[model samples]
Target: MLQLYGNPRSRAMRCLWMLEEVGRPYQLVEKTTHADDLQTAEYLRLNPNARIPTLVDGDLVLWESMAINLYLAQRYDGPMHCAGPEVLGLAAQWSFWAVLEIEHLLLNFLEHRALLAEFARDPSVTERNELLLKKPLGVLNDALAVRGYLAGNSFTVADLNVAGILMWGKMARMDLSAYPELTRWLDACLARPAYVRLRDQARRK
Candidate 1:
């Protein structure tokens, strides 16, 4: 059996969604935000980084949510998995592009505006980053103008990874009226039956 240790509200949600998409039975070793559980010697042996999401599949131990999703995709040969080296390259490209273009910017906004106390946060930092995000967002919006999904025409890891990263924008509550194409694409991604199951399962846990 596969054992995945992490809370659903965290990055592990992506992995959970991937698991559901693959339709594979697995155990979710649900965890909390407590340091005691995350930093235990036993847990550290599986993930030296002491992260909440550590996937243990028999002799294989893996960390990092995106990589874990990729593993599941490849292992099960799901539709999200790349069909060849060329397609795999595109998946990798979109994944990295989303992280570099939007992930950190969204995190900056969340940490400054939502995580920190009002007195401790520097609104200027979040505001500046928010402004800078428009360029990359515009690029994404344009790329998605004529397509229903990223990478290829159908859903794949490229869409899954990029959509997961872009979801932070929804959390940040950024005004997205300008990116109609992006908004349309994201709505479709989040509306997937697999993603819905993932969300409901996480909430129940």
Candidate 2:
């Protein structure tokens, strides 16, 4: 059986959701971030970065949440599986775009607005990144305005990966009313059964 190391609340949630979508049987190894479990030599062998998420399948070990999801989608027979090279390329494109163009901005805004202690929180940082996020959000909104999904007609890894990062924006309580299309798309993505199951599992703690 495949073993995935990470807590459901972490980026591992994305992999968990993908696994659920693929209807695969796997074990969640439950390594919480900043915990000693991730620092051990055994765990380091699987993921040198000491990250929460590391997947082990036989001799193949993979880290990075997005990469893991993309692999699962392509390797498995499921709704998220890429149909062809073009679909796979678009999936990778949106996944990378989400990480590079949007993830850091959302992270900074979330850290300042919610994750940080009151004394440590910086409204300036939150404000600046929130402004920065507008451009990409608008771009996404425009893209969604023409298509229901990012890559193809149906929901795919591209949607999953991008939505996974954008979820942090929702956590930050960023006003998204102006981007109706993006808001609708995100709402639909989060409402999927797989994502719902992931959230339910995350709430168990």
Candidate 3:
């Protein structure tokens, strides 16, 4: 059986969502960020970085949430793969693009609002994030406007990977209202039963 390590509320949620989409039975070994368990010898052996989300399938131990999801999609989503090589590459592109291009600014504001509240608040910083986000958001909005999903019309791993990152932006209160297409796309993607099931799982104790 596949053993996925980490709390459903963390980055592991992405993998959990993917697992649901894969329609396969797997075990979720929950771990909390507050606990020092991540640094424990047992956990560190699976992921040297001591990350909350680690995937253990047979002898293949994997960390990094995006990579794990990609692996899952490629490995289990089809007899060959749910997505072809082109879509697979697009999945990697969008996932990497989200972290590198979009998440930096979103996380900056999230750090200020969620994690570093002790620091003086600056509305300008968040406003700047909103401003900085316009270009990428516009690109996504335009793309989603033309297609039902990121890679093509059909829902693919790219949608899950990219939308998962965008969902983080939404949670961080990025106010994507200006990009209606993007907002609608995200709403549709997140409305999937798989994502909803993951949310319910996260709410569990």
Candidate 4:
């Protein structure tokens, strides 16, 4: 069985969400971000970077959340694989876009608000992040305006990947007043039973 290592609250949630969407059974192994735990030799051996959401399937070991999801979809599942070019062109498109444009901007704000709270709280950085966010949000608003999902017309791994990162902004209480379309799209995505279950499960863990 595939053994997933990481807390659900972390990027591991993406993997968890994918597994649920694929309807595959896997084992969940919890890890912590605590300094001591991260520094342990055993954990370091599993993930040299000490990051969470590492996966061990047979003798294969991998980290990086999105990559794991892509691998699973490609190897274990079919069109569900967000990485496949032919089956889910848009899936791959939005996945790449989400990581590059959306996640990059979101993380800028998150890092400022989280790891670098003092620096993030700086008016200059906050202002910059706030400004950067509008561009991507606008793009998303326009894309979702005529379409219910990010790829095709139905839910795909692309939607989950993009929406998963966007939910961070929502949790941070980021301003959404100007992006009504984006807000509406996000609401609709989160309304999915899979997403709701993932959110509830993450909260519990």
Candidate 5:
């Protein structure tokens, strides 16, 4: 059996959702940032970076949530799997875009707006990030408006990877009403049964 080491509240949530979508039998080992589990020698052998997510399957060990999800989608037979090389390329494109263009800004916004304590929170930071987000969000909105999905007509790994990052936007209570198409697409993606199952499981932990 495959073993995934990470806490659901972290980026591991993305991998967890992907595993659910792949319908694979895997064990979640549950390492949290708040604990020393990720720093231990045992965990370090799987991921030298001491990251929250590390996947172990046979002799293969993988880290990085996005990479793990992409690997799972490519290796497994499931709905999230890419249909072809072109689809895989597009999926990789959007996944990288999500991390590079949106993830940091969203994380900063979430921290300042909600995650941080009231006294520690910075309205200026949130305002700046919100402004920065408009451009990328508009780009994403336009893309979704064209095909309803990122890479293909139907949902695929591209949608899953992008939506996984955008989940933070919803958690931060970011106002996305300005981008109706993006809002609709995100809502539908998050509503998928596999995503719902992982989300509920995460909350229970």
Candidate 6:
């Protein structure tokens, strides 16, 4: 069986959602955020960064949430939504675009707003980061205005990956009113049963 290391609350949630969508029975190898867990030599061996959501399938080991999902799709042919690049050009496009565009902006906001907010320092840089996010959000909103999904008209990995990151804006209460199309698309993506199960798992953690 495949073994995934990471908490549901982390990026690993994406993989969990993919597994559910693919109907794959797998093991969730819980890795806590405790300092002890991260500092352990054993954990470091798997990932020097000691980040959550590492995948181990027999001899194969991989990190990075997005890469893990791609690997899962490639190896297991998970579900129609995650069809391989050759079979589904749009699916791959959206999937790759999610990490390429959407994730870049969202992660930037997360690091600058959430992580840096703790120290209350870098106020100037924070404002700059906020400004940086607007351009990407606008681009995404424009793209969504014409299409129902990021890659194509139907749900796919692109929708899941991009929506997963954008959902954070909801928790942060960062008004997305300006991006009505993006918001509408997100609503549609969140309505999926696989995403629902994935979200429920995150709440459980």
Candidate 5 residue lDDT tens string, 1-205: 9898887788888888888888889999978786477777877888999887889999999998889888998898767778899999999999999999999999999899888889999999989999999999999999999998999899888898889889999999999999999999999999999988887876786
After aligning candidate 4 to the native by TM-score, how far in Å is the CA of 112 from where it should be?
A: 5.3
Q: Model 3 compared with the native: what TM-score?
A: 0.90
- After aligning candidate 3 to the native by TM-score, how far in Å is the CA of 185 from where it should be? 0.8
Worst 10 residues of 2 by lDDT: 29-38
Best by lDDT: 5
Clash pairs for candidate 2: none
lDDT of 5: 0.89
Model 3 C-alpha lDDT per residue in residues 102-122, reported as the tens digit of each score: 877877777665656666767
Cα lDDT of model 2 by residue, 23-133, tens digit = 879999878787587889988878889986888888899998899988998888767789999999999999999989998999889899899899999899988997898
Could you tell me the TM-score of candidate 5? 0.97
Give every collision pair in model 3. none
The lDDT for every candidate, in the order shown, is: 0.82, 0.88, 0.81, 0.77, 0.89, 0.73
Candidate 3 regions with alpha-carbon error over 4 angstroms: 114-121
Q: Candidate 4: where is the Cα deviation over 4 Å?
A: 77-84, 110-120
Note the residue pairs that clash in candidate 5. Answer: none
Please give the distance, in angstroms, between residue 127's alpha carbon in candidate 3 and its true position after superposition: 1.7
Residue 149 lDDT, candidate 1, scale 0-100: 73
Question: Cα deviation of 184 in candidate 4 (Å)?
Answer: 2.6
Ranking by lDDT: 5, 2, 1, 3, 4, 6
Worst 10 residues of 6 by lDDT: 78-87
List TM-scores for all candidates, in order: 0.90, 0.97, 0.90, 0.83, 0.97, 0.81
Error of 4 at 58 (Å): 1.7
Q: State the lDDT of candidate 1 residue by residue for 78-143, as single tens digits.
A: 676678886678777877787777888888887787777889899898889889999999988998
